[model samples]
Target chain A: MNSVLDIAFTSNIKRVWHPVFRQFGLLALVLPGASLFLIPWLWMLSTAGKDTALIWKTPPVWIPPVYHWDNFIKAWLQGDFAVYYLNTFYISGMNVIGILISSVLAAYAFARIRFPGRDILFIVVLSTMMLPRQVTLIPLYMIFSELGWINTFKPLIVPLFFGDAFSIFLLRQFFLTISRELDDAALIDGCRRLGVLFRILLPLTKPALAVVAIFNFTWAWNEFFTPLIYLDSPKLFPITLGLHRFIGRAQIDIQFLMAMTIVSTLIPIGIFFLTQRYFIQGIVITGIKG
Target chain B: MAARSSLADFVKRRFTQRTEDILTAYLCLLPWIIGFLAFTLGPLVFSLVLSFFQADLFTRNIFVGFGNYIDLVQDPLFLKSLRITAVYAFVSVPLGAATALAVALLLNQKVVGLGVWRTVYYLPSVISGVAVAVLWMQIFNPRMGLINNALKVVGIEGPSWIFDSTWALPSLIIMSLWAVGANMLLYLAGLQGIPTHLYEAAKIDGANVGRRFWHVTIPMLSPTIFFNVVISLIAAFQFFTQSFIMTNGGPNNSTLSMVLFLYRKAFQQTRFGYASAVAWVLFAIIICFTLLFIRSSSLWVYYAGEERDE
Candidate 1:
């Protein structure tokens, strides 16, 4: 929550005599670097709207002569992106609900309840985070195939309902920050444990919940590996898979590829901009307190 | 001591409370426990067992008992993939951390439109996926690509990145650095948390800027740096998506990451047992490095208010 100007150890007395000089110097260095960071995005925007002839033009054009915005329409139509978008939304929606419910309940218990073997259970949860998902891919694939869940959203969405390690850990940290007195007072007023959670705790942790939701949504939206393995049907492919398939099939059209890439990036970028404050706060809390 | 006794008292009063705290806790944890058993723990143990047998999707699983693992050691492709991943992980972890820390240091200084700058720098990392991979693949194109075109202006001919074996792995490493903003943000957060008084104190003690940075800023920031490094290391080891999308272990399998190799084995070739063995090897390598990091962190990572046992 610290303001940008509230930075520690930035101000040096030696440079205090010429504050204006220092500011300009910092600006001179930073502006170009910031622009450098933004080049790929600007390039993406430029490329997505360019004419096919200009795509191969040597000394690549910075600005397209005529902005062919229909490339977006063309890419969408050609790639079956509507279906991919719908499938991605469905999967992301299911996962967000699943993670929020399971993580909130588990996090609340870990944060507030004094129960036997709580420490060991929490350790197991933490250990799961470190264990690479690759190690479990084969068996999980087998299990899903055995249950006839392959090529369905079930393999993609069901496991998240049990909750994920990182989300549970993040929510638990946020929950621990709330005072125990709030829970105690609510309990004293005949608010049951679940009631206390719903009425008292949930409201205070909305920011954390939003953070978890945004993260899960983005992760599910951009997810490729699981979708690639589980869902073979093009109809079931999410944005990432759909885009990959599109790229593979239409290797000749650079403009369409760029347009499709933009389409795939749009939702997550929109979410990031809208929920930026909460996103930064979530990362800071996890980095410092984790 | 008081907290422990209070916890003990709370447990003693458990019977007086109509709702069993333990039962409620268990109820709350039921979903995660089930998930752990079914998805994570079960698959983990199953995969370990799977590594021992020779099983294709259609054939009966034969008990080979370390035969798959022995083959993994001798397999040139597995060894090549491991080495590629190791190099990528090792190089990227330090390179990424240093670049991020540098950017964070610059960004920490009071500048106009700080929020915009942060957003600009961070957008790439946030939007990472197939889109990113595709974008970079285009950017690294030797002919008429942004990079080579830019280099052409300077009269330097650029190599065909991601297409030449010599440059393919390096191309992936370079692409990896594009997402340094995640760690940069972490460093910025860590920097803001340091007490200004420490800087003033260091200045009063006649420490110059370089001395202050080395002695105070670094020590204070060590824990954050350590955390970033470990997470980055772990992530780099499992690096995929981009290579899968961009290179597909191409240009003579030069960019074949361990996970990509595992994926090819499992999905493409249907070598389930061999892939499972590769997975276990990757797991072992990751664990060893993580343990090494944790062990070495004691010597360098500084936590305020924590006393060294020595």
Candidate 2:
């Protein structure tokens, strides 16, 4: 009966949809869309390598007549992007470290420990995810300003130490997936709570931790508005803010601006390529669960 | 021996293992608790209170209860920003989701070099922030941009995109579609999760390709679609950095989003009270929209094995 049914139904469907045509059709449809997405990046490269004069020429150059390696150097020096790069890295590093420590502990507690108000507190954490950042932007600014944190990296770096909502939530979900048996067994074998988290749970939850770290780093590195609001001094600006400032200047060459823009984009793109698995896994986990 | 036994007895009597567990949990949660109070709850309450007063960041604090809210309703620019934001969110969210779904469906099929294709599409979404704004600024440049240059090749003249008031918002909406790869990834994950047996069953039941897709794929994928829609809608409402960088609410406030308007009010203009009011209104709108979607979700969203409340 199964063979007959398979032959009748599957074979009929197979005949109706040829594999070659289906494959060809998919490629034909997808390749155009993919190329369209590539245009901006390719155009940035093309324009960045062109002569400053040629960048704005009509029927714009898709390829530079000659590659301008000096454009990157000129743009980098022009914007003091070295300082921006260091500042961004510092911020991202601090955020990743703080997020890991705080989120891991909080997530472990929420996942494993039964405390009074645990559920209520977890609900509060979840609701904060829904609370738009704009709603708290002004008051946070005011609070930070009162503390003399404005124009310093403290405002950017310190709040993250308290544990971000998304990171904690993601880590918590991951911890719940891990068996409590491993934790209990560790405890029975004379492990402390932190020890179980650090030794047993942390080793197991490495993927989740990587996801949290990668995302926090990318977000901190790409962060523009926070730096825009907090950092007034050009010397303290991250790459995003620096790039914004670079473009705001009049008499700036288009090629040079594109060069700086490309420079600002490189690290995040490189990070994405290197850690695409964790990045996509993070998105999938959050998307499905949330 | 007597001292050790007494000490152990005292410790055990003072703290049960359950009590110790609770204490440990709270200790672990202390950082988040302090943060929640300082960053989340405190600011939330403070923002609400500030909305009632008229204050610059400094010393102009004067109580004008409901005055900021009233003024916001009457203010034309505030209303305009709301409309612009709604229109942008409504257009961009669905458009992005649909495009993402389509791409995901295409990619779900038997294809070679899937990784390369996926990476190529997903790469653009990763290079976000001010970089995206700058890249698209050049891409939409009327004279020197790729779009216009390509249009010129086809003998069609393109409008001054980000510069023209009429086209600026639409230009942004178009620019937004380029980064749908993130949503596409979500959809791909969802697609993979849908059991293949359902499709085969539909085919066996004499359902054609189109029918099989509609009956099998759509229902199965509805949950994911719903998720993407809610997330994208919320994100769209808060859209700022791009417009802030690319247009600065320009070509006559055509691209002025609620967040951008609030930014101008608070940061640029230092009307902290007024911006707080705007923020509250924006918050209310976001809540209403999210609730509306969730409330209406039962009508369309299908979770396999879960019984609907019909």
Candidate 3:
């Protein structure tokens, strides 16, 4: 038995250490995926730190001699990204709160309550998820125009107060997984339905709520279409729309643009890195069921 | 005391209980109901109505009753946009899904610093679409872009990727592949869900790694593959941000997508009714394609813990 165990272990090592296997083992797998995914960002970072001359040089410098940390400062200042950041944060923050409040209420009802036409109404809400926002763009614009809401943040933020189908759907799925006995107990404790939702379910569903918040934050921050359509003032533009002004028709400053691009992406990437565990779990469950 | 109460009193109490139940349900549903009516349902119905008319910026909609749809069918540019969208969807969806699956398969392997690699791969997924477009525009710059320089080192010259008509769509497709992290994460979940016993059984049967992957892994992962395909197809059809930012559908509308064209018509040209018609047509196309995919999925999508009909 000892010899057999020894042989098995040695053979495993030999198999792993085989020249062909070892040559292609980890490096081969990591390289192609990494290059495909990482090289562009590295290029963006490297170029953003280079001067114009170095940027335009033949054979291009993959790495700059000195990192121009000030380029980020310059990009931030000159691009008026300070204002963009403020506007973006304000809008995204409001939108997240709005989504959470309205979606939680709606999702709780869908998950816990029995009502006439409940299934049909839920299906109607879910069906809206299938309709691309583009399909409704023109009509929505017309409505906003009639209301004189264009060029204002109203168009961007107001609709968010109305529960989004995707958000509600996700939150409802989370709510459904929770036991009903908790709600019954809350009712016996003199808690109203709304009170139960706030005190009992919301606390238990922190991960789901976090997922919703993170999703909303990133999406709202990166949202370009609505901002571009509704916002006419450059001061009101988000980082996404503001960044486009740098890439004009005739010529583009490659380094400056890359620098600005890298800077703009940092916030969302940072948020994702911070909350990735919840985000991944959310995606897995949602995508599989959806 | 209950025996002494009149029948009318008990009936009145029951009526009140029913009304309370109804009121409670409506109260809970108020936000979604109002939103659905004002935002979603309202706009949808309005679009359906407006698609039958022609409206300028200031005038009342002139009823044309399918005129815009007819024009869409006849317009060469609309046809071109539709074809472009179809091609974009077909190419990008498959490419994105394949890359995602490949990366997920790699990440599923027992490796060091797995978390770091996962984060690295996911970084692009979180980056703003406009930022990615701008970044890639520079990277694909014909002269000094890293891609071109790399090609020059190999004694080959890279084409102007964004500017060249032939390369613009493909450039966007390549850019889409950069954000495969979301799908990769989905695939990872799918991979982990596959029972390990299957692989072990295959190994004991003297099946090579390739055979095990084909017979065991691929079949188990088909549902995820199907899901990715459908979602990616839907997204690719509405491809707008990259083209709008990078190319502005430029160089003779080479990169003009269905959504971008709709945007141009509605926002730029101020033909709201016409754009509505175009949008409806797009919706129909998407529905048809989605239904087709869903119908076809039964042939391939395998659900665990379900009996196969055949």
Best by lDDT: 2
Query: What lDDT tens digits, residue by residue, belong to model 2 across residues A58-91?
Result: 8675777799989999989888999999999999
Q: What is the lDDT of residue B203 in candidate 3?
A: 97
* Candidate 1 per-residue lDDT over residues B178-203, each given as its tens digit: 88988999999999999999999999
| Highest-DockQ candidate | 2
- TM-score per candidate, in order? 0.94, 0.94, 0.93
**Candidate 1 Cα deviation (angstroms), residue A261:** 0.7
Report the alpha-carbon TM-score of model 1 versus the true structure: 0.94
lDDT of each: 0.89, 0.90, 0.85
Where model 1 places Cα greater than 4 Å from the true spot, the runs are: A1-17, B1-14, B306-310
Our tally of clashes for model 2 stands at 0
Predicted candidate 3 versus true structure: per-residue lDDT over A1-290, tens digit per residue? 57998999988889877745744686578767787678888888898898888988997777799988888777777788888889999999999999998888888888887778888888998888888887777778878888999899999999889888889999988988889999989875767777888899999999999999999999999998899999999899888888987676246456677778887888888888788898888898788665
Task: Give the alpha carbon lDDT tens digit for every residue of B5-70 in model 2.
Answer: 989987885567678788899999999999999998999999999999998876869999999999
Question: Considering summed lDDT, which 10 consecutive residues are worst modelled in model 3 chain B?
Answer: B301-310
